[model samples]
Target chain A: MHEFSLCEGIIDAITAQTCQQGFSRVRRVWLEIGALANVELDALRFAFEVVREDTIAASAELDIITLPGRAWCLNCAQTIAVGELYDPCPLCGGYQWRLTGGNEMRIKELEVE
Target chain B: MCATCGCGETEPVIHPHDHAPDHAHPHQHDHAHDTRRISLEQDILAKNAGFAASNRRLFVEQGVLALNLVSSPGSGKTALLSRTVQILRDEFPVAVIGGDQQTANDAERIIAAGAPAVQINTGKGCHLDAHGIGHALERLALPKGGVLFIENVGNLVCPADFDLGEAAKVVILSVTEGEDKPLKYPNMFAAAKLMLLNKTDLLPHVEFDVDRCLDYARRVNRELDILQLSARTGEGMEPWLEWLRRGRHDALIQQINQLEADLAAARSRLIHGGGAIRRTVI
Candidate 1:
């Protein structure tokens, strides 16, 4: 699955950070998942566990925070609550939208000791 | 300002009266009227991008030419790739990195076409990634001066955004598919460097308009080369095969130059930092 590739990226990111910080162990990992990123949180956690067995993050706790998907309706010129990639504005029902915020998936920070 | 209606000019504020706090002197959750901002600046895919860049560099250093083939199901991608391998195998060493949802059918077909083939089962994944291709390269047993063709899963929409470090990306649309495909799936056309309008043999009976299709492809990607050919009848295949041969030849030369450069860099680095490194993967 492409999930594995994405997992590989996560592993690489964690490993790179650990190496840079000169940390030998990682106890906890903080991750922010975007609702519109098309990534499954459980699958990501599972992949982390599977790939971390021989790495520094083997026993790391993956703390995931989900950000809701939102969009800025072009017609209304205001942000709206939306759930999908193609969403119509509640105010004007316009298809054209400039995604303003809430779609973010990143390793916000790490906890290592 | 309110994000939804822009009616609430001031941000919402909540105090201790909004919730009853536990009498515990210190609490994890504290009700406050202060507003805060979360500043997220790092990309989630930052790490993936690093590895991808390294893989691209490796390909460049090895003088390896790569291609990603994307098309819809039943568009004859595998068949066309098979023909591509057959036609060019004797001319030069070629290999294939075949991607599919769950079957070894395409790999088997590619191997039968008389070249090395590696199958990547994406499970439920819809597209192929650079890391997947990197892993496949380990088992592909490809040789120097080799051109690896990646046959992506049959979909036009999802695969365009992911870059597999391909030197060239080709979009194959058969005559059976309507001409509007270019306009409908402009992303694929925009990403690809070559467009193969395959199954030209059926043009006589099919409603596909080649002129309109070419025009649409040009409209989307003005620089993309449009090749119309029927791999079955061998009609219009000469130019296609020739183009493939020339491109691969140039790619091989480029790879040789890269390997030479890498070798030189390793030699100089060894003088400064002594270490043993493997030269040939084969």
Candidate 2:
């Protein structure tokens, strides 16, 4: 599963960060998961918890922020928010809309003390 | 911090050196503490980026032209790669790393078409990553002038996020699938370097719009190389084959030169490490 591997990556990143900063404990972790990233936040969190034990981030709390899918219509020349990716530009009914933002899974920040 | 530990809890033992009287039992207060709000603006994948960059560096040093192919189930990725194996087998030394959920079908197809192929059954995994490819390469025994082709598992959305040490990333879409695929899944298209509109032989009977497919791909990736071809009929394969050959040749020559240099350096290193100048270059 992508979530399982992504959870492994998260654990690796968190481990490397804590080791580098000399922080033996991670208090909180913030992840910015885009709506279009196709990542199930719940599954990812569950995987993270299962794999993060015995690491500095074992006691960490996960905070996720969901970003809405967004795209820019070339004909309309304006960025618009849509429920799905290709919702035919709401302003001009143009199908040729370029995705500008959203659609990614990244950890926003980590709080260590 | 646990309410009782404070990083100094010792099995709730008496502090061996305590000379003062013990305090009364804990109070039964019911006051609720407010939630802690912390500000952190960091990306979770920020760490993987470093390893990805190193993988790219290794790819560049090895001078291998790696291409990661992504597509949906029954999208003809195997067919397209099998076609490439036949076309580029003699033109460019090539190898393939196949990813699938089960069985070595794709790898067998490429091997049957005459090329070195290694199957990576991700089992429950949805995509291929650089580390997996690196591990696969150790078993492939590829030499200089070798072109690496990685066929990711049949998934569009999950494979886009991974950078698998590839020189190019391709998204294969057959006309049998709906025309609204690119519109529906923008991330996969955006991540691809080119989009192969496979099975174009059925264009006449199907409701697929070649122009619409190209337009959608270009809309997402402004520089998307849109190639419309049918792996079955070999229709519209000339340009695709030519482009592939040119790319592989360019990368192979570089690899050959790098290997020669490495051999020379190793000889010189041996000479300087207390050995005579009896270096022989065959």
TM-score of chain B of each: 0.78, 0.74
- Interface RMS for model 1: 11.7
Show model 1 residue runs off by greater than 4 Å: A1-113, B1-45, B263-282
lDDT of 1 by residue, B3-58 (tens): 32222333222122234544443333254322222233456667545546766666
Estimate every model's Cα lDDT from 0 to 1. 0.73, 0.74
lDDT (Cα, tens digit) per residue for candidate 2, span B1-282: 233112223221212223443444222224432223334354555544554565556666767677888999999888888987888888767888999989988889899999999999887788887766666776785534557888999988888888876778888999999887887777788778778889999988988877777777765567678888999999988888876777777776766777788999998888787555344432
Candidate 1's TM-score reads 0.62
Error of 2 at B273 (Å): 19
lDDT, candidate 1, A1-113, per-residue tens: 34555665666666655433434567777778777665667778888888778776788787888888787666787888876554556788665665555557677776665
- Best candidate, DockQ: 2
